[model samples]
Target: MATTNSLLLGFLLLHIAIHHSVPVEGHPNYSDALAKSILFFLGQRSGKLPPDQTMTWRSDSGLSDGSTANVDLTGGYYDAGDNVKFSFPMAFTTTMLAWSILEFGGKNRMSGQLSEARAALKWASDYLLKAATQTHGKLYVGVGDPNSDHACWERPEDMDTPRPVFSVSSTNPGSDVAGETAAALAASALVLQSQNRTYALKLLLAAKDVMDFAMQYRGKYSDSVWTACPYYCSYSGYMDELLWGAAWLHKATKNATYLNFINSLGANDITDIFSWDNKFAGARVLLARKTLVDKENSFDPFRFQAEDFLCRILPNSPSKTTQYTPGGLIFKLSSANLQYVTSITFLLNTYAKYMASSGHTFSCQNVLIKSSTIRAFAKKQVDYILGQNPLGISYMIGFGTFYPKMVHHRGSSLPSISSHPAHIGCNDGFQYFFSGNPNPNLLIGAVVGGPDQNDAFSDSRTDYNHLEPATYINAPLVGSLAYLAGRYGSG
Candidate 1:
């Protein structure tokens, strides 16, 4: 006990020393720290607490949600600040997580995030396998009752609410969800292939089956289920998922059919913004990478669409598309806008790396999308999220000294001390309560819903869009930050 206490004291002192070293009046060098922060964020949002994991802040979560629908829904990551697990976005996040590791894991492996990244991805992949196999060909798309889950403000570990599960069948299709899940499984197969080839093949076969089901059915899940609307809805339509799933499937397995399918689609309706709901941007990037890196001249048709889309996102395009804040964040929707910007940041960094490697300059309408330009824009976006913006506050939790304290996350807001013991659970009734003080446990590394157009922000628990953090928001940031840190060396 004495030795342990001494070690703890030493660690605390070291932390304080490093904390004081951060520049008081400049953009703090938090790239390395922020990379670790992203891992912590994922760890906290994990559904099932592993034995080796040490998340003292979060009690064993998603235990009650286990065995819902008589299926073991025990090993996926939580969707957002809420306890629910929407498998569509959850799988999307997992796909990005695996992609980050595969594309940029070398430096991260040295940085100690690779293990956490693998564990996080495995957690979701395991759940996806169960979700796929339990119901034969059809996959479980959505888990948890968002209506019931959101009604209570308690932690996932303490919840006694209804834990219902939802799925997609051939008669009732969910192309977006199933396609995204296939993308996740396919991407994860690459990550796991070398480590465990047997399991990797299982993921591949499952991905093939899931993709086949999704393509064969060909309809958005949100249209079929009223509960999935507006929250985890497919805003950009379902065709994007078909393209996205094919792109991933092609990447996982060098299949000529997947390439032909994407080629037949022609110029994709360019949605300038991308998110969990939208996979067009992701699909375009993945296809472009394949075209550039392939030793053979296969998938060469994708080069045009990829270059076209890339040029649109970059500044100075003839279109002059993509709105930006005064602080320089690529703004899309007013609600929780950082999610959109961070997603773009990750994509830009990825394309930039690919462009740099290809040594070929891309232009659209005579506006050059050079490697330097892409890197500069991506770095600026990253800087804004850190502390370089007008507000001079980092959007990420537990990074800079100043960040959102009253985040609109139930898990972060619940009182550590029970003022009224009887009112702990939503047994009698419930009223949405926001704690007056800062969150008791720092949801470290969480990138909250960020500032407004004019760089205004309120650290109020009532502001849901501006304060709540989600896994999708942080997932890209992890990959983005890792790329930046590996390229430039963390500050």
Candidate 2:
């Protein structure tokens, strides 16, 4: 009897060893977790984060005493730390975070990252509930600093005197707020519902109010006050994001109204951009292809837009372009643009769907190779940060230039052409750019610059006074780092 038992145990041990020896693709957990982690980290790595210690949505009272009201207007405000607070910018950021987290967590659970997955689920739940409760039936441009004595509509005149009017209005709207906010809320509700049916249903009902408000106002996208101008509208270059939120809402509620709304926007309006905005469109396109393709939805605009942009930028070959720099650093440019990594990644995942629906393939291997290059570049940038580079001067690789500043354009502020680091104003604020990299190894992203060197933004002149982390730069970093750690761990 003892000999027989020993033989059985030996056989069990052999079976386990053989399982461990199999390749990762055959290991369901390995494949799923890796995919989830990569997707979440990629999405997060696209945005900026706050420079100051305080979370963006916290009551403004605790902020530094002398901090300017205009500080909230800077891009960093959109990258606020906590998801519990729901303001306009926070709402947008949180929605992106929640979707990524939930998706990652679900994959993690399947891949055996149970604890981490649960934490992500919990964070998403708390955020969605808080956002739903705070907004109730109405969506403002975003939440205000709770500590401020001013009303939601109040704006400061020249950073000193406060005006009675609210800078954001639910009615008489201006920027992409109506579309962007509504889409975010709707997506959040849908995700929550998929996870927790009861809670999600309630949130969906509440979210309908916000959607209704947005739908009631069918004004031109240019009238959106939340963003700066027509150039910033989702249609100008980011219709995908608007569509992503809308698609999720459509899926969650199974509401024909949302589908009809999206259909009316038409595909011709979608523009191709390299940022997450384009991913949003890809995501929605996938959703639409899944749920509405058979419902007589028009395909003309989507085909035209996809062909126009994809054909124009699709690289003919995987070639690298180099430019000489006065500095020792080598700038790497590819046939594919780095800025379009987010959109390209989305397309990679969803291309089959588009092909089936539209009979066109946006096959651009350069997009994928460029993304890998950007990931490599991100590692170098992070190294530069940890090395104590002053004022966090980093380059976007392909451009061979430092971050651009907001310059006055047609009576409004817009990101100017990329310039050298030595030209950036207010070098103090640029240091935050060195925070994290896109690699699984956090150290890989460290900035290698020496401690004392000053970049362009460091000037004590007017440029310094106007400099701050743009929202586009900061939110993605925070989201990406957290997503990476949660998904892939230190490896």
| Model 1: pairs clashing at backbone N, Cα or C within 3 Å | none
Q: How much is the lDDT of residue 170 in candidate 1?
A: 85
Which candidate achieves the best lDDT against the true structure?
Answer: 1
* TM of each candidate vs. truth: 0.90, 0.47
Q: Mark the 10 consecutive residues where model 1 has the least summed lDDT.
A: 415-424
Score each candidate by Cα lDDT: 0.76, 0.35
Q: Please, what are the lDDT tens digits per residue for candidate 1 over residues 1-491?
A: 99999999988866653454434343445466545555655444546565665545565666655476787777677776777778888888888888877877775432667777777778889888888888775678766778887777776556666777788888889988988999999999999887899999999999999989987897889887666876788887788888998889998998988778777766368667778988887888787776676534565556666666667677777865777788778887888999888888888888888878878677778677788888889888887887667766778887766777877776666643233333368532224354466777667778888999888998888788898888888877778777766655646
lDDT of 2 by residue, 1-491 (tens): 99999999988866554443322121112233233332222211112322431212111221221123222221112221111122343445445544444433444323444343333333333433443344334333432243231111111111122211123335554224444555555555555555577766666665565555555644433354433231233444334444555666676677887778677655344334434334444444445455334543564454444444443333332332223122212222221122233233334323333344444333344343233333334333322321112333332211112322231010012111122112222222223222222211111111111112122233111221223222232223333333334434433
> Which regions of candidate 1 deviate over 4 angstroms?
1-31, 42-47, 64-68, 108-110, 295-298, 416-423, 427-432
lDDT of 1: 0.76
Question: lDDT of candidate 2 vs native?
Answer: 0.35
